[model samples]
Target: MDRNAKFIAALKRLQGVAPIQVWPATVKSIQGTNCTVDILNTDLIDVDEVNLRADDEATEGVLIVPRVGSLVYVGAVENAVDNLFVCQVSEVDRVEVKIGNSLVTIDKDQVKAVRDKCELTLSDKATLKQDQTTIELSSGKVKINNSATSLKSVLDDLTSLLQNFTVTCAAPGSPSAPFPATITQVTQLSTKINQLLS
Candidate 1:
């Protein structure tokens, strides 16, 4: 089987929720007919909760899929476990993809998808780097791991994927806004008292 074909078969064999939500990502390696991608899905919030979790080869694993006419790549990084590339799937085999109306065949040149459920771990700090596979496809958004901030988020990128939100009160002696007591008579009295101290 070809690199694209093997990955496509992997994709087609996939079933259940085990398929990691795959978005296009950097390519890693392509030996023989098997192509690889360094994929990440930002929509997948619980990296720790969801993984292939498959101990046996016969068990189900996550799969990666790209829309038809999409381009994908894998493995070309220097000394890196995975690199990157860009290949447009020229001929799409038929298969049913949950995201779209069409399903791809198990083998074809444009087989821009993979079937693999992965378990990714994190460090003491929030940052994480894990290895996963996918076929070459472009979504105007791509990440090696979607657990953190990427280009897709334009609005300050709010979420655990990139940040952990924290709220703190101002310290004592911190500056305070001057009160315009004229809006209310009670406020005016308080302002007068504060002014006396000034």
Candidate 2:
């Protein structure tokens, strides 16, 4: 046994161990969970569509799809044939989750939900602005505040109408005492007018 022969045998044993291979790739197209990627810096192999690895929480969480032209990691066992997978997405544009039939999307600007119904509650003040506003209520009643000027105008119009109107009545059982019966009608009208003022 020589030292050089022993070294060569050790080198051969090391070479027999399989290694993991990873390469940077660009996503070409995506269909469902399968993706086609172009491996960079390699011309020895050509890979077609590879199955994308779903995250562990994919059952109840989101599965992000790598967009075309985005970078990703392609992994394979060394010396193995036809076993390549899209390991992870190097660039993420958005994250989307599916809940029942609804889809929730989150991006840089906003978080939006596509569902049948949604409710929002604000702890602080909320301000809404528009050029014109219209509110429809189930009940057909609406209440409005009367300004002092408008109330005064209404009272003045009522007073003018009452002053110009005259009421006539027939004497009750006695033509000689007609003035007394008419005086009672006038007193009743005065009492009604007092009620309006209050």
Candidate 3:
């Protein structure tokens, strides 16, 4: 009739004498790579120690950890409930991918990447765009658009010039000298700028 009914019928036909090896379940709790779930059947049955299936196999692949209260499809091998594992999930709490020495992880709040070395060689251009701002790398040069430059070297030069600012005056002491508290104010501003930017 429907997709689920058709799928179950197909499984029944294929398995013949064996019990259905797949069913929908709701995640109840998680313990490492294993989870506890309430199998959705005529009667709710709580199954424990179910493994979460991921492509990970030591060296490389992806792993997705399901969140509690998420709907998942639980599958078993050879109709054995003891071999139960989550084959699919409707929601995820975390996802991680690994390849050789590189790793990328994504969670609710942030995405992190770790690698030994990363290199990008583009024939034409490589651009990183976010919102309305863009950074482009082309022909061994970097260009930033719609964003203020916060380069430390440029800021340092401006800070140095401000610290050494002076005006020529014919009056008393020194013909060329900065205003009394200009160096202190400039130094404080430079510190704040460095704290706020790169």
Find the candidate with the highest lDDT and give its number.
3
TM-score of each: 0.15, 0.39, 0.53
lDDT of 2 at 135: 19
Name the lDDT of candidate 3.
0.71
List candidate 1 segments past 4 Å from native.
1-19, 40-198
- For model 3, how does the per-residue alpha-carbon lDDT over 1-198 read when each residue is reduced to its tens digit? 999999999877978666547899999998867789999973656788887754223557777889999999998877787878898999999887778887877778656565654422233566555444455677887765444443444466576776677665767775665565666656666765554454
User: Each candidate's lDDT (Cα)?
Assistant: 0.33, 0.58, 0.71
Q: lDDT tens digits, residues 99-181, model 2?
A: 78677766555555555544211122222212222111224432211222233344555576556545445566643433554
Count of clashing pairs, candidate 3: 0
lDDT of 1 by residue, 1-198 (tens): 899999987876763323333344433333323344444453422112111112213223323333333344322223233222233332333222222322223333333222334222222222222333221223543333232323223233323212533334367777644233322444434444343222
lDDT winner, 2 or 3: 3
Estimate the TM-score for candidate 1.
0.15
Q: If both were scored by TM-score, which would come out higher, candidate 1 or candidate 2?
A: 2
What C-alpha lDDT, on a 0 to 100 scale, does residue 196 get in candidate 3?
A: 40
